[model samples]
Target: MLMNTPKSLPVKVCKIESDARNTAVWVKHIQNDFEIIWILEGTGLHTINGEQYSLSQNAVYVALPGDYHELLINPGAQGYIVRFDTSRPDQVDSDYHTINESWLYYYFSKTPVLRLDAGKHDKMKNLIMLMEQESAAYSSLHSEINSKCLQLFQLYLRQHIELLSNPSCTYKMNSLLKQYFWLVEKDFKTQKNVEYYARELNVSANYLNHMIKRASGYPASYHIRQRLFQEARKKAQYAGFSMKEIAYYLNFTDISHFSKFFKSMCGISFSEYKREELKRAV
Candidate 1:
């Protein structure tokens, strides 16, 4: 059964199982803060974002924050479901699944699932069952058990990325677009205008903007200013350097100019932004 968590949930490590020829519970459109499902016995089907994935007894399913998913199983399916909240910035034991949209678009363009080989599946099963037993029986060494659980969790992710990466996929790159992203991704916060990047990339500013928007769905200027803003965000704090020094480092001619630019972009003075971030961190 999937549960709704309106907040990011901090889950330690735990596993639950539904056995075939034993129990029947259909998992429907529920959002989880963090979920990892591993197939143990039979086969089943899962739908995430309306994409259906076939799952055998060795498949691992991952539901990141705010993901909509539903589960349907045949008569002879068995598996384990572990739900936890770890990506939240604060508080454990709280689940933040309020929305029904996925944040994975920033990174993962496809569904997040991993199917393991039989040998790896057996190893995962052992770790999951052991965590269940230790958590079920309280002992003075609870932290030790938790550490082991996190280790197993890491092992799962390592295996997942290894199998998911297709070396052949790199050949599919749109060269000009790839270069555009790399240029902006490597230098977004310090430069905020399209014309400058256009000069460096040797394209006219108009052409650069068009290609950037076409490729990344964001304006080239947006990427540049974003990069500059990122640097401003970092330097507005702890850089005992005077505002003038910060301005010059960012290639601004004068402190007043930098201040205005920062204010225009961030709606606040650099000092104010730094103070706010510090307050939040504290």
Candidate 2:
């Protein structure tokens, strides 16, 4: 993924790419833009924000903006990658950084990996292929490609609800509460601090706390623990990584600290989490 400029991002409305094979995608650390990887064939591993996973054929992984992740693609693996900018509609200077970042991270984390039916997979693949062909043709109807891309996105949403049976919404924020909830999930690891978010929103930490608590019947810290637990589960999925490696990889202050954090969040040690996750994977 490249982040030369904000305009380079073709998200918010539409984005299209085709035949993405044999491309060594080592770029990470993006300030803006969201990304979605739809695999058509083959297998590869992706490290998102320091966690890693093995992506099989015909699967999808959605990445939110500001997340620093990279991919290790194998030969012959092809997919369409998309990045959406959250700040597009919401002006950057209109609000505080912490509040904006929290909401941004929240929606960004909503995109979960989905395995689609063969027919659905073929449909998306064909749409991507057509977009590629249009790019090669260089027709004057350039807007057509963009329009087709939007159509493809709609079809994707349709399949997302009908085929996959996932009820999660896409891109747009439904409410301010839902928005901030997701942002905390996406950025808890890097930031680890939530009060800064309240401050940035120009509100008291107690106000943010009371708002999240009253709305969700839980404190804002719940989202922090939720994200940390998710990361711990992910760490359990990868093998051959030592305890210390996992700790540092997860940005824990130290092994002891990570152990405490894991236990505090999950009621188990890292080793136990790994064992359980492996058994579940099997």
Candidate 3:
């Protein structure tokens, strides 16, 4: 019988190599962390967000924060389970941040499984092993070494995942819209208007807005505001930065303007939101 697991786990980076079926207990929990399960030798069932995936040798499964997942490992199944807290800024590299965002929006947003070929499987295995070794060594530089290894692992995994899952563009308009969304994610902080993005993509503003709305049910300006507001909310949570500093960071003309924008979009004053967040944390 499966048991309910805790809602959150302690923040850390750790790896375990196991062949034991008892590891299935991990699947019972929901964590506010990202996990990568590399199946070196296993045959079982993996489910994420109510979707079932066949677990087999050389397959990898990724779970994002708050995503419910389960693994039923059969007898004799073996694998490496790696987990790291997504909320820890000190442990995450900037490259990992970019890749994580891309994965969240592109791949993991839809599918959580990546089945790699033998060569790629072996390469990833080697990187995980190196990370495991460095983690166990506990040397003065162990954290740095492990972080670098994880960066390489993420880079390789993303490249192969893209190759495997690249969507066939049946319509050129779909491809163009995807490019426009990518640009919005990359430049939302400094550029918030549809005209700027349209000019950068070499299309007229009217056509660009039409295409984006047709594809995503939202206009291009909506995406820009959404991304900027997300960043603002994140920055607002940090106690170190004053509201004025956050407003400047997000390119708002003034603190009052930023506050008004935040309230309009988020339906709450910035101070009230932060206070609620603090209360929840306490």
List the candidates' TM-scores in order: 0.47, 0.48, 0.56
Local accuracy of candidate 1 as per-residue lDDT tens digits, 1-282: 322222222334443344446544455444545567776767677766446787777667766544546766656665677665444424322112211111222123244676576666667777766665655554666435644564566455554554655533321225454555555544454555777678777889898778667645666776566556555644565436566777887788777988998899889887887677567547
Residue by residue across 1-282, what tens digits does model 3's lDDT show? 221122232223343334454544444444356777776775778766446787788877887655656767665666776666545556566555555544444455456887777777777878877766666556677666766777778777766765654343212234466567657656777887899989998999999988777655678788788777766765665556677888888787878988999999989998898887567446
Clashes of each: 21, 6, 0
Best by TM-score: 3
In terms of lDDT, the best-performing candidate is 3
Q: Please, what are the lDDT tens digits per residue for candidate 2 over residues 51-135? A: 6778787777756554546776666665566544444443322232333345334433644466666666666766655654554
Worst 10 residues of 3 by lDDT: 2-11
Give the local distance difference test score of model 3.
0.66
Clashing pairs in 2: 34-83, 34-84, 102-183, 105-183, 106-182, 106-183
lDDT of model 3 at position 215: 52
Residue 77 accuracy (lDDT) in model 2: 66
